[model samples]
Target: MPAADQNATPPGFGITLDTAAAEPRVVVTGELDLLTSPQLQEALAGLIADENSRRVVADLTGVTFFDSSALNVVLHAQRQAGERDVELAVVPSPAVSRVIELTGVAEHLSVADDPRP
Candidate 1:
């Protein structure tokens, strides 16, 4: 079996996890659609499972594309976060913002400003 890189990046996509801060942040890049949504969901799920992860910020500023599937994954993560007593926030790209606006999912998520430093 191949060993997994702690910084494993999916094909055509990348995820950066920063857990040192008060709130863990997951920065995603590349296209987010049906094919890549599962990878994102899995990453979010791991964050939710962590006991120290009381709050999570998903920074999608680097996302070039997004779709309904991507929206659903974020929504699901939000719901799971609630169940785990974790607060979830998202820094969406313009493309993601458009879908959230169209689907009325924005109200359900805490949208944060991009926190890249």
Candidate 2:
């Protein structure tokens, strides 16, 4: 039995930040669960904290798995964005859409079918 590599990144999981756009975009891919939700939280929080940021787009179209943890992050980010006077929109993939729809959180957050506004 060999010890697992704790420092290794999970396969197919990635988070990319694009601030060059008119609105900052956080692009997420792969599974989003308890282990990876923190990363998302951090990313969104940073974007929301920017005083000049008017909107933030979270592109989850590449996500293959969505979980409650990820949903929590999204909801929290939405609230934060609102408080900061910043809009938060989510572009969901099929996997994420199912969870968002089932949880009935879709009404609470802004959802976009297309990545662009």
Candidate 3:
């Protein structure tokens, strides 16, 4: 997919889980903004509900935008993961990282900057 496709919407964002990783991982691509946050939460729920998967690594390599609504979902997921004693790691896109850092969400998200493309 081209970079142009990532900023555009329901068509862009996608989540895929890789259970084969040793730790269950979720691949997050495209925009996770106001319009797409719910989808992210839904996808996260599918993994968070499973008791067997403790470590959740979110790969935000292709994400280009971030919003407070998306922050809510990530915070919610982090809280749930905390309650379950599941380790949560977020590989945030630089854009997303900057937003989180500026908004004080950096503390809540166990985030890394500029991951693989």
TM-score per prediction, in order, is 0.84, 0.93, 0.81
Write down the TM-score for model 1. Answer: 0.84
The local lDDT score (0 to 100) that residue 18 gets in candidate 3 is 80
Query: What TM-score does candidate 2 get on C-alpha atoms?
Result: 0.93
Clashes of each: 0, 0, 0
> What are the per-residue Cα lDDT tens digits for candidate 1 across 76-117?
999999999998889988888888898887789988876643
Overall local distance difference test of candidate 3: 0.77
* Rank ordering of all candidates by lDDT, starting from the highest: 2, 1, 3
Q: Which structure among the candidates has the greatest lDDT?
A: 2
4-95 in candidate 3: lDDT tens per residue?
A: 55335576778787877777777888888877888778767767778897877877777888888988998999898888888678888887
Model 1: how far residue 109 lies from native, Å: 0.8
Model 2 clashing residue pairs (backbone): none
TM-score attained by model 3: 0.81
- lDDT of candidate 2 at residue 19, scale 0 to 100: 95
Candidate 2: C-alpha lDDT: 0.94
TM-score sort, best first: 2, 1, 3
